[model samples]
Every structure is written in structure tokens, then in C-alpha cells.
Target: MTPIIVFSVITGYFGLLMLISYLTSRKSDNDTFFTGNRKSPWYLVAYGMVGASLSGVTFISVPGEVANTGWTYLQFVLGNIVGYVIIAFVLIPLFYKLNLISIYEYLKDRFGLKSYRTGASFFLISQTIGASFRLFLAAIVLQIAFFDSFGIPFWVTVLVTISLIWLYTFRGGIKTIVWTDTIQTTFLLLAVTISIIVILSQLNLSFDDAIKLVTTSPKSKLFEWDWLSDRNFFKTFTAGIFITIAMNGLDQNVMQKNLTCKNVKDAQKNILWFSITFLISTLLFLILGVLLYQYALANNIPIPERTDDLYPLLALNYFGLLVGIVFLLGIIAAAFSSADSALTALTTSFCIDILNIRKTKTVQKKTRLYVHIGFTMLMFLVIIVFNSFNDASVVSAVFKVAGFTYGPILGLYSFGLITRKKVKDKLVPLICIIAPILSIILNYNSEKWFNGFKFGFEILIVNAILTMLGLWLITIKPKTSLN
Candidate 1:
């Protein structure tokens, strides 16, 4: 496909998003922009989350991972269900009771200002890097498909894509995001389902035969009980728990949607339904990967050099132009599903938590407008910088960065909610810094030091442990006076 043509199709899709944003923004207030006025329908939020949680990173990365880990990645998603249940019933209630505008504010009330800023800062760092990496992966596919033709650099494509996202999302914020996410999620699911059907037809296998072929493939195996290794079934499962809890239960990006529901009960229902949809949707993608491998085997299609490119290559070669167009639409949908929400959430958190902007009060209208514009510009700048240095895999980079910030937040909340351990507010920053740095060191050298056993999911555990221990060292217990 021509670069201009591909660009036009992508632009058209985003234009639709822009239209939705325009209509939604007409009713948006600070509450709507930040939390959808706490009145959004649970089912729509749940449906939209499937796409937001997976994104293009999962869309491309999961199938690639399947080629290596078999179906064992599903173990993490299975673990995610346990984590999601905890968030729905346990975490959501805590936030609702606190009546928090920003979830991190609960940390401030429970702990102190230092702890609150620490949590929010960590989220800012992790979410930014993680979101950028997702965009990086999507940009790679678009570049390969179009811009690689005439010496147009990848960075140019990246900037243009970010620009389109920023333009549509600058005004409507979360109210717009909820609806946009639902639309994008629909496209993403359709893309995956259609790709499976196309690949099955190519193998001359009926749907039943195709599924049987996948089920029997080596990549289809799901369980590995080893606890000593990175992909150890138990370890990956545990990691899923921490990842879902830390990122969704605590982070602004995911919970920002949860907070939009009309009441605590509805928010809980939204989270519960989101888990089911996310789990089933990811399984479908994994099945597609297994079938893609089978189709490759049967038809003698050459697998791409990197597994991440497998879906795109197959779409381009195996399905002809029409199917390839559909695949492109899916890729765009997945990419924007997470990216747009991240941009909106980042702005929401920063404006509300850091700038003290309020949607409920109209007096500060001019200041809030500036803050929104400032955040939009900042996003454009950060994405440009992130796109320039693209050397790592999207998933690994996201987890690594997430580990740094999420661990400390996990520790902060755990300490405050589970115990009345009177933490010294002044020393909070040092503990948060030390915990993740130490965890990274352990993550890197754990294998060599521990007889080839390594920390994967256990890294979060260690990070949390280190943070807790650090807090203990810094906190001074008060003496109770006998009355």
C-alpha cells in the first residue's frame, strides 16, 4: 500500500475518533473530564477496558510471545482474574469510601503528602514510558508497511501519529475517552477474529480442524509448574496478580475509568465484567497465534525474522490486499485504544493532583484550560523523545519501568491500609528510591547468584518487600502514654 493511502485510512479512523471527542466534550465538565462525573454505564466501561488493557502492545506482542512461551502466557491472564476480583471487590471499595478524586490521594490521607506524591510520580514515570513503548511498536508496523518505502524516517511517522492523537483528545478528556475506547475495542476484536478466519481458510482446515491443530501444537501447552525460572507457571501467575493489582487497582489510567461509574457497586460491576472480557479477548489472540503458526507450517509460509512482525507479515502476504486492509484497521484500533486513554489520564492526574485544578469549580476556568493545553504539549514532546530511542521490546520495557514505580506505590498502600505503622513522612522518598533500585539489581543478577534461578514475577514481591523493610527502618514508632 502507498504511504499516503495508508496514512489516509489511518487518518480517516482517527477523524471518527475526533468526531466522537467533539460531541462528548460538549457535555464534559471537570468531573466528566477527570472521572466521567461518576455516572458512566458499567457495561460500556467494562467492554472498553478489554482494548485498553491489551492495546497494540498485546495485539502484536502476545502472539510473538506465544511463539516462544507456548500458551503459558495465559497463566498470567488467569492470575489476572484473581487480581481483578480483588480490585473489584476490595480495592474499588477502598477508593470509593475514601471518595477520592485521584486514587493516589488515598495514600496521602492514609500516609502523608510525601507518600502521595511518591505514588503519583511513580505512576507518571511508569505510565509515560509504558504508553510510549506501545506507540513505538505501533509506529514500527506503520513504518514498515508504508514509510520504509521512500526513506521517510520512522520518527516522522511517530510524530504524525502522536499529533493526531493529541488533536482529538485535547478537548473532551475522559468523557470522550470512554466512548472512544468502546469503539476502538470493537475494531480491535473484529480484527483478531477476522485474521483467525482468514488464516484458517488458507490452511484448508475447517474451524474445528483449525482449533484442533492449535490445541495440538507445542505452543498450545498452558502449564509449567517450575517456580525457579522466569516463565515458571507459578511465578508468572503471581506476577500477573501484582501487575493487575498495582497497575489497575492503583494507577490512574485504569482506575480512572472505574471511578466513572455511577456508584461504588456499579464500579465494582464494571471491573468484574472487564476481567471476564479481558481474559476471553486475550485468549482469542493467543489462539490466533497458535493457528498462525499452524498455518505457517501447513502452507510453508516463511515466518518473519522477529515474532512481533508475524501477524503483520501474515496479514500482508497470506490474506491479500483486502484482508491486509482489515488487519491495518485492527492495528490502528488497538494502538489508539490504550494511547488515547493514557494521554487523557495523564492529563487528568497531573492537573488534578499536581496543579490543584478542579472540574467542579468553574471559577478557575482559564487556569484549567492552560493546564490542559500544557499537558497536551508535554505529551507531544515526551512521545517525540521516546520514539527516538527504540532499542527494547515493548513488553519487557513496560514491565521493567513499571517495576520501578509500581513497587513503591504497592508498598506505600500496603503499609498504610494493612497496618498503622506510623511512617516518617520525611524519609518516604529515600525508601521508595532504594526499593526499586535494589530490585533492578536483584532482577539483573539473580540468575547468576542463585544457581540459574531468576526473579520474574517475584521481582514485584522483592520490590514490595524491600520497600516495606525500608519503611520500617525509617519509621519511628510512638510510645503510648498510660492515662
Candidate 2:
């Protein structure tokens, strides 16, 4: 597709989202922005979570890695199913029971003021980086496909991308995102389904032939039993369980939408259905990955050095004009669905956790507006910084950071939920900070120190354990009774 056509496609898509924003935000209030007035339909939230969860990182990175990693990510997805079940049954009920706007409020109730702040602070730091990573992929795509033609610097593209999200989300917040994300999810699914069909038609391969090839190819290997390898099934599976719990269950962004459902039953229904779809959609991405590698080999196309670029390069340059336009829309949808919510979630957290705005209810609407704009700007800066230094696959980078950022969170929740013991609330901030730093040191030296025991997705598990151990140490002892 020509740059003009690509730009037009994006413009029309944004216009559609803006229209949805206008409709959704018509009677917006703090309740609408933070919790969607607790009236969102379970089904819409279910479908929309898929797009927000996958985002551009998964859209680009999953299929790209298929050539090398095969279907092993399915191990993580399987683990995620288990994780989602835990969230649906355990975490969802707790959030609804408390009627929480920010999930972090539970920490305050269970522990003390310090622990509450610690959980909210970790969420803020981790989510900012995670959201930035997701947005960076879309920015890269736009720069390559359209902006370069106009001699536009990458920063301008980043600004425009972040600003559009701010423009729509500042008013309605999660209320707008719930509707916008459903629309984004529809386009995302359409784009993937169309891209798969186009590739099959181009290769003249029947469904049976495609399946047969994927099953037989070494590139489609799904199991890694090498205990020393980073992609071992056990590590990936366990890590998948904890990562989901930490990133979605413990983190604000993912849980924010679920808390918007009318009640616990409705929210549980949303999560349960979303997990099944999340697994199937990811499976489709893997199938596409195998097809991408096979197609490249057959046509004598040189694979891009950074495998993350493979999907975009093939779609935009080789898949024909129609596929290019759809793929572009898919990525944009993925980007906005994720980033827009992160902005809302961040604003919600800051207003609730940091500023304690509920105490000063008079200024909430005005305060939320300023906080929303501040996060939008923060995300832009983070993306620009990432663009300068990013070298690893985005999926890998995100997971690696999650290992550090989410580790303390997973630890805090585990300690609070599993045990009825009192915590040294004042010590929690110190413990949360120390756990991640220790995790970094241990992850850095594990291979050399442990005779090639590599930490992959399991880093989150290790970090959480360390955090729990720290919490255990700081518990108060009961005095002996002399009767």
C-alpha cells in the first residue's frame, strides 16, 4: 500500500474510535472513569480483554518468534488458562467483595498504609514501562509505513500516538476504553483471520496441508525438556501461572477492567470466557508464525535479523495492499486498546493511591484530568527512551521487566492472602524495593553460579519467593506467657 493509503486507513480508524469515545463519555463522572459505573456487560468486557492483553507486542512478537521457538508459547498459554481460573475464582471475588476502584486498596486494608503505598507504587512503575513497551511497537510500524515518507521524526509519531489516546480517554476513562477496546478487538481478530487466509491462498496450500506442515516441521517444536535451556516447559508453565497472576491479577491495568463488571459473578464470567478466547487467539498467532517461516523459505525471502520485524515486513512489503492495510489496522487497534487503558489505570491509581483524592472529593474531576494528562506524557517519554535503547524482542523485554517489576507484587499478595500473620507495615516499602534488586543480581549470575541454570520466565517466581521470604522475616513475635 502507498503511504497515503496507509495514512488514510489509520485516519478513518481513529475517527471511528473518537466517535465511540464521544458516545461513551456523554455523562461521564469519576465512577464512570474509574469503574465504568459498574454497569459494563460481561460479554463486552470479555471480548475486549483479549485485545488489551495481546496488544501490539503479542501481535508482532508472537508470530515472529514462532520460527525459532515453535509452539512452546502454548505452554505459557496453557499456564495462563490455569492462572485465569485462579483469578476468576480467587481474585475476582475479593475485588468485588470490597467494591474496590483500585485493586491496591486491598493491600491497605490487609496490611497498613505503608504496604498499600508499596503495592500501588510498584504497579505505577511496572505499568508505565509495560505500557510504553506495547506502544513502542505501534510507533515503530507507523514510522516505517507512513511517517518516513514525510521525513517525520520518530518523536512526532510517538507524540501523536500518545496524544490521540489522551484525547479520547481523558473524559470517559475505562468507560470509553471498554467500548473502544471491543471495537479494537474486532478489528484485531479480523486482521489476523484475514492475514492467515491471504497467506494460505497465496501459497495454494489447503487447510490439511498447512496443518500437516506445521506438525511435521522442526520449527514447530512445542516441548523443551532440556533442564538447562531457558525455554524448558516446566519453567515456562510455572512462570506463566505466576506472570498472569502478577501482571493481570496483581497489576492495576488488567484488573481495572474486570472490576468494572456489575458484580463478582459477572466479572468471573467475563474472566472465564476471556481465558478460553485468549488461548485460541494465541494459538492462531503461532500457526501464523509457522506459516510465515515456511512461506519465507519457499519464496527465498531473507528473514529479518530481529525476528520481531518479520510479521510487519511480510505484511507491509509482500502480502499485497489489502493485507498491508488490515495489518496496519490490527497493530493500531492492539496499540490503542492496551495504551488507552494503561493511561486510565495509571490515573486511577495515582488519584486513589498517591493523592488519596477520595479524602478531597471536591477536586476529583479536575485532579483526574491533570493526572491523566501527566501519564499520557510520561508514557510518551518512556516510549522515546525505549526506542533509543531497545535491542531484544519486545516480548522478551516485556517479560524480563515483568520478572523484576511484578515480582514484588506477586510476593506481597501471596504473603497477605496465604497467611493470617501480621506484617511489619513500615518495612514493606524496603522489602519491595530490595526484592527486585536481589532478583536482578541473582538472575544475572544464575547461569555462572548454578552451573548453567538459566532463569527465563521463571524469574518472576524467584523474585516473588524472595519477597515472601523478606516479609516472613519482618513478622512480629508473640511474647511468652508466664502463668
Give TM per candidate: 0.95, 0.98
Relative to the true structure, how large is the alpha-carbon lDDT of every model?
0.81, 0.92
Off by over 4 Å in 1: 359-392
Residues 291-396 of candidate 1: C-alpha lDDT, one tens digit per residue: 7777777778888777888888888667776667777887887778777888877877777677666644455545656765665456556666766675655666
Checking candidate 1 for backbone clashes, the offending pairs are: 30-359
lDDT minimum window of 10 residues, candidate 1: 359-368
What is the Cα-based lDDT of residue 120 in candidate 1?
Answer: 83
lDDT of 1: 0.81
Candidate 2, pairs of clashing residues: none
219: Cα error in model 2, Å: 1.5
Which model scores highest in lDDT? 2
**Cα misplacement distance, residue 226 of candidate 2 (Å):** 0.8
